[model samples]
Target: MISRFSNVNRAYVNTVGISSVFNIGDSMQITPSIKVLAIQREQEIYYDEEGKFSQFPIFEEEIPQPVFYEQLTTNFFNKNPKINVDSISVTSISSSAILQIGSTKDIVCESRTKHIRQSKN
Candidate 1:
């Protein structure tokens, strides 16, 4: 197997990310798991000559359960036995991503994001 990478000036990997990989790489196994919950609340109040009123309610939500990595990995390998790649070339990889040059037994990446926005006036 031969891998040649050229003219790679700059690469940025953020949060849960993978960088660059050079030649003659073998058996690259990477497992990245991430869970994110983002909540935003906005409230606006208006006042007149008579009076002013503003009301905002509380927000409540339950978080989801985590993923089973062992089962996922087993299922992946069982489904795909022979995943062969002679050569690979890439410019960049970011945000729970993978950059593989050669052979690998297993590669599993999982990400879950939940966003909630509440506005009151």
Candidate 2:
């Protein structure tokens, strides 16, 4: 396979992320699994405020079950074969993205994110 890249300004990959893939000459197989639990708290205060801010509490029962178990037991990819690519050209690949130019047998990617946000004003 022939891959040509002209310019790549920036790439931001986070957590379980794949930024870019220029080229895969031969066959490629990838299996990636990720589970993330993120909690964020925000509080806004004014200049004329007087009293103190209350505490933020997180109870044990508020949490939920994990996300990896159910996904692990499932097979979501196709069982059919794929044709190979002859040539490819990419100008930019940014921000948790993927660019592949080749043949792939089985590619399974699983990502679960549980985000909890609390804001007080």
Per-candidate TM-score against the hidden true structure: 0.39, 0.38
Best by lDDT: 1
Q: Model 2: per-residue lDDT, tens digit, 72-97?
A: 44444544434344444555644334
| Candidate 1: Cα lDDT at 109 | 68
> How far out, in Å, is residue 91 in model 2?
9.1
Clash list (residue pairs), candidate 2 = none
Q: Give per-residue CA lDDT, model 1, range 10-110, as digits (tens).
A: 43433324332332345546666555555566754443541211221212233455677674322222344333554344555554565544455666666
Candidate models: Cα lDDT each: 0.45, 0.44
- Please give the range of 10 consecutive residues that has the lowest summed lDDT in model 2: 51-60
Question: Tell me, what's the RMSD of every candidate?
Answer: 11.6, 11.3
Clashing pairs in 1: none
The TM-score between candidate 1 and the true structure equals 0.39
Clashes of 2: 0
